[model samples]
Target: MTTIADRVRELTVAREPFVHATVVRAQEPTSARPGDAAVVLPDGSIEGFVGGVCAESSVRAAALDTLRDGATLLLRVLPDDTATFPDTPGARVVVNPCHSGGAIEIFLRPVLPAPVLGLAGGTPISVAVATLAEFLDFEVAASGDYAGATAVVVAGLGKGEQDAIRAALDAGVGFVALVASRKRGAALLDELALTDAERARVHTPAGLEIGARSPQEIALSIMAEVVRAIRVDGLASSPGPAAARPQQAVDPVCGMTVLVGPETPHARVDGRDHWFCCAGCHASFTAA
Candidate 1:
């Protein structure tokens, strides 16, 4: 059997986002005891067990939510009739219909890889961006590879800046910005044969209008814009269904968001379709 430590090491080295669930409190009739731990992978699979199928479903759901929102969770799973749940701030309560008559408290924490910022040029501004990004808790890459970078910044040093920007855009990096004067930036953009949509993706004169003069100030402005772009990208990428309806369904058992698709387990109840993260959730939903 693989231990939690072994799984943690494996996941850490692989840079996969996961949630660690540990049972800190357990009442009678529960299959799990305090200290039981489990790891929930990105796909809603549990590598360990915190309790029986019912408890596992809830834990899995909470774990996935934590991964998505990058927030730690303290979950309390009780029977459907549980009324006097512990009044605690930030504690999520899950009503378990299939529980044998026990309560389980599981703590879930998300382990996510740091977002990467790729720097294309080794100019003073690039160096400053790297330093400042590090301060902002982003992993900085100076190679301009953009292979796995969430954002790329071309700190122009007069040579190869256009090439770097071209490479970044060609690679479909979600966010790309170039630091240069308006004239130089315009000239370089004219040279590139990018479509209007693609050209619009490039943020020329990268950074906010903070009147930045020095390389350090420019770096700060660029980072601010980068952060804004990241947030905008996130909102645009997952705006749910049209008309603002959520494309993803929240698993009622555990509250994890499940993309509505054939592969996802789902059930139709009360003339409505509900998706679940896993079989365990489906079972719990049916039982309820």
Candidate 2:
């Protein structure tokens, strides 16, 4: 049996984004116990159980929110009629109308993969960049494949610079750079059959203008520029299909908001489809 920890490892290795939700506290009449955990995927599908179906609805919603903002959240799911506990600071509180008179506290943390830097050469500058990028918590892909890389640097000294640059651009990498002299870089860019917009995205004579002479210094300048592109310029990794925002719907039976996905319960009535948080809600709506 694959444990939650094992599933987490698989997701991490696959460079997928997900939310780890652990039940920290549970009130009476709730099915979930303390330490019960679940992995919520980017599509809002849950791998384990955190609580009852109604509580899972709240957890799913909050998990997606945490994934979006990249923040850890303490979620308090309470019954609609219960109000004894005061709101805790920095914790989100959700009252479930369909909850069976119990409460649950779940901790939601988003696990995001580290940024990948695609280095397209084995030159001294490329070696230095790989070392520095690893130190800065970047995953170095030295295979000249930029499929999922957030940044790509061509330091092959004009050997395969054009092909690498074209591949990086086609991969939709946020930062595409080539290490060469200003004159050579401009000439090389002109050689590529790319549109004006695509050509503009490439950074020639890569790295910040820090007067870097040595290979190590040049690597440092390149890393600094990559950091600026990520932090200041907001050029983070290109989001995959799984990172798309989850669609949502409101369950009319319980007035609870639920994520609309393959896992959600659905009903077609009178030529219209209605989504529900759980089968119980779906049954109730269909029966009435």
Candidate 3:
């Protein structure tokens, strides 16, 4: 049987974003135990058990939050009670009213793929950028493969530069740059038939103006700009379709919040759908 760890590895290889949830602490009367692990996909589906259905609801919500922000979170799910725990910087506390009088603490960590840099040309600057990008934890690929790249750099490729730049722009790659002199870059941009908005997206004379003279220095400046774009400007959004938050509803029987998904227990009543955190709630609402 494939374990949760094995599944995580597969997802990593596939460059899919997911949250790894592990039960680190469980109070008495809870069904979950320490070391229980699960993988939460972007669509709010779980592959393993962390706790009972009610507790799972809380885990799913917190897992999605961690995935959105790319942060590790310590999720504390407590039975609705007056007792309190010390506040931790990276921890989130949720009171599960439907829980069976117990608490579980689960750790949620988001695993995201590294940003990919599409590099063109075999010039010295191109070689330097590739080497430096790897050191900065970026996945390097050929400039032709800019379909999902966060950034593309066309380095002095004498020919076919316009093709690569046009493709990257059309694909909406966040950062597109050309390594050329100011005059030459402007001339190249003019050669391409692009709209004003599309023309403005291309960065001519790429990299920070740090008076760089050597290939390595120029590479450093370019990487610095890329980092600014990612960290400061939020230019590197997730590569694929925008992640949409799961629809949510309240369980009328228990007043517990639940994520609405295909697998969630729900009932249609009077031409409307009523969601439930567990099957018991669904049955109770239907019976009433």
Candidate 4:
């Protein structure tokens, strides 16, 4: 029998995105009770059990499904060979078991680690962008902490700004924004050996459609664009099939993934449907 502390440590240290299936409550005749724990790996492997073989099997499969969604889940195993489901992120499976003759409730919550968004800047405007991004929930870490979405916005790309952008792009940050004059942009583009497509990804004058002038305004615009990019790229699931069409294929530029169907975003590149998530991505692709 594993100690609760050991199971708890496993839950904390497991290196992949996963879910937690814990026997939160169980009937007297059930095999599980509060504190009984299990670690649901990204591959759906399970460490501990809260129920019989049949019930654990159900939990294993469900854990994988939840991992695919990058969402948390809660499950309950019922007695009488009839599964009773909870109305929340929980589910119940019914099975007649010899050991656990009663119903057991388990919580399956997904653990999605925060993505690292490295905002490489030190200017007042850059500081504002950092603050706004944090307010909006993008992980703000150092430039070297490139675990997830490493987006680098070159702050007012003046004489000293190239180092930051160079470091960020070299680190393979998916998103790069350049806040510089068009002349400066031209110079940087010429200097960097990055491919045309890679060069195109850089947002020279970063921000949304809103015309921003002040530091706060510029920050808001840049943040809006970041939010747009995040909505377009981040996450495993769409808000739904409507707000966002499911996309198994993603557009690298705008970060929209078009689902496989008639609703997919495709661009006619040399008479071929270059699949895209939006016209913006298509345009970026063509421009590149």
Candidate 5:
């Protein structure tokens, strides 16, 4: 039941914001089909494959755009004759365009209003982090699949689980944690092929390092770190400076800002955009 249609319908019904990447243009001999698409759920799970891993890499960064402006974008992912992302120096060239020949262009369009959550896995310490996150009034989902934004906590180092933790880091899931020896954390991270950004978000031996021992104490320290991130780093997805931007007439359906200007997609019901976010909102706006 996890079809493109189903995800889209769920997103619309739930009033979530999301990004869908599709293979719109393809060269001959490549595996990319016109309709092949990947829907990045607000929860961070992805369905379908426009271009497999390579394409997914591009999609991950592009999805964050929706969180910023609530705008839809069509990305053109071209096969790099030379290895590496445009600006990145270490990336290897990825050319298997879904087993098809030549390069492919993937279109990433966003669907807005996706719910954001800081998902804490079943760590013994998440008890406190979860509690504080809820008290902060964040809309949390039991499964990370429903979150628009996510944070992973991997405290209580066990065994053979670096891959899962690494994947979260690669996805750039806002925040990540590892409660254990910093020496071990550093060694573990060094074993992975990760970017600087990914490495940076990996807070190993997680928590405030406030000499916490038990699950409850550790949870407090971890939650404190998350709170610190919210206050200083602006890491959470909640509306930001845009909320403080001078109030202007907004077209709710299209979400465009209008100030004593021409007609908006939405006429004044009682007001214009009225603090609306995107063009889609402006378009959806029905006066009154």
Candidate 6:
């Protein structure tokens, strides 16, 4: 039997996005208890139980919102009488209309797909950026071949920086940054003579203004901006889908991530190929 932890690992490895919801508090007449958990899928189906159908609906809605915004939420579903829909920072409140007459507090944590972050240089600052990005759950690559990168940071010591930047731009990377001094970055941009639209895609200075002094601090600043580009600014405008999106599928029986391939064991259900990790998984899915 695959445990929930095992399922989570499979999802992370396959880069499939989902939400993990834990019941931290459950009031009287509730079907859930503290520490109860559920995996909420993109389609609002839950693999585990946090509460009854009423509470599950609320969890699914909040989970979808967290996935879309990439934000953690502390959700409170309260009974109707005292439901004021309190406004709090980093928290959200929803009333359970099922009138279960029970209050439940569930913490929803989003497990989003890791975006590829490409670093063009091998400098100390670039290395630091990769380290920090990995810590923040970004798939970091230190090469010019940003074939799977949604964001690219160019800081090569005048070596292959231009080529990297051009390739990222041509590939329609969502965010392209040049990690250079203000003046030098400006001069390089002038030399590139990119179209206004293309230039808009490049972030000169490549980071927030934090008055950073050391390479590590500079890298931190750049990565902060990179996150904003993907989670904040990038979502504000419609973007064309990049070529680097990974193909992923979810196992209906165990909620594990399944890589679609001919060699992998699979079954065609409802006119779609449902891949599985092993023969056991396929059998379990078929039985279900």
Name the lDDT of candidate 1.
Answer: 0.78
Error of 4 at 205 (Å): 1.5
Per-residue lDDT over 1-288 for candidate 3, one digit per residue giving the tens place of the 0 to 100 score: 999999999999998999999999888899999999999998898999999999889888888888878989999988788345567788888887678877788999999888999998889999999999999999999838687788999998887899889888877787888999999999988989778988876887989999999999999999999899989988873256756889989889888788998889989999998999988888888998
Candidates sorted by lDDT, best first:
2, 3, 1, 6, 4, 5
Per-residue CA lDDT of model 6 for 122-240, tens digit only, reads: 88888889889999988887756676577888886595777788888887676788988789888888888889988888898888999998989998999999888766666222234
User: Global lDDT of each model?
Assistant: 0.78, 0.89, 0.88, 0.62, 0.57, 0.75
Off by over 4 Å in 1: 157-159, 232-288
Q: Candidate 1 — which pairs collide? A: none
Name the better of 4 and 5 by lDDT.
4
Could you tell me which 10 consecutive residues in candidate 5 have the lowest summed lDDT?
238-247
> Better model by lDDT, 2 or 4?
2
Candidate with the larger lDDT of 3 and 4? 3
Tens-digit lDDT track for model 2 on 1-288?
999999999999988889999999888899999999999998788999899889988988999889877899999999988865678887999989889877889999999899999999889999999999999999999786677788999997465788888888888897897999899998988889779888877898899999999999999999999999988887878555655667889999988999888878999898988999888889999999
Top candidate (TM-score): 3
Q: Tell me how far the alpha carbon of residue 178 in candidate 6 is from the true structure, in angstroms, after superposition.
A: 3.0
Ordered from best to worst TM-score, the candidate numbers read: 3, 2, 1, 4, 6, 5
lDDT of 1 at 232: 58
Per-residue lDDT tens digits of candidate 1, residues 97-187? Answer: 6567788899999997777887887878888999999999888887756766677888765668878877777666767888888888888
Residue 20, model 3: Cα distance from true site in angstroms: 0.8
Stretches of candidate 3 exceeding 4 Å from the true structure = 82-84, 237-244
TM-score each candidate.
Answer: 0.77, 0.90, 0.94, 0.63, 0.43, 0.63
User: Could you give the C-alpha RMSD of every candidate to the true structure, in order shown?
Assistant: 5.8, 2.3, 1.7, 15.9, 20.7, 9.9
Number of clashing pairs per prediction, in order: 0, 0, 0, 10, 39, 0
Q: Tens digit of lDDT per residue, candidate 4, span 96-208?
A: 33224667777777775544556665788888888887887666775544434546667754665667666665656667777766787878767876787677657777777
The model with the greater TM-score, 1 or 4, is 1
lDDT of 6 at 283: 89
How far off is residue 57 in model 6, in Å? 1.5
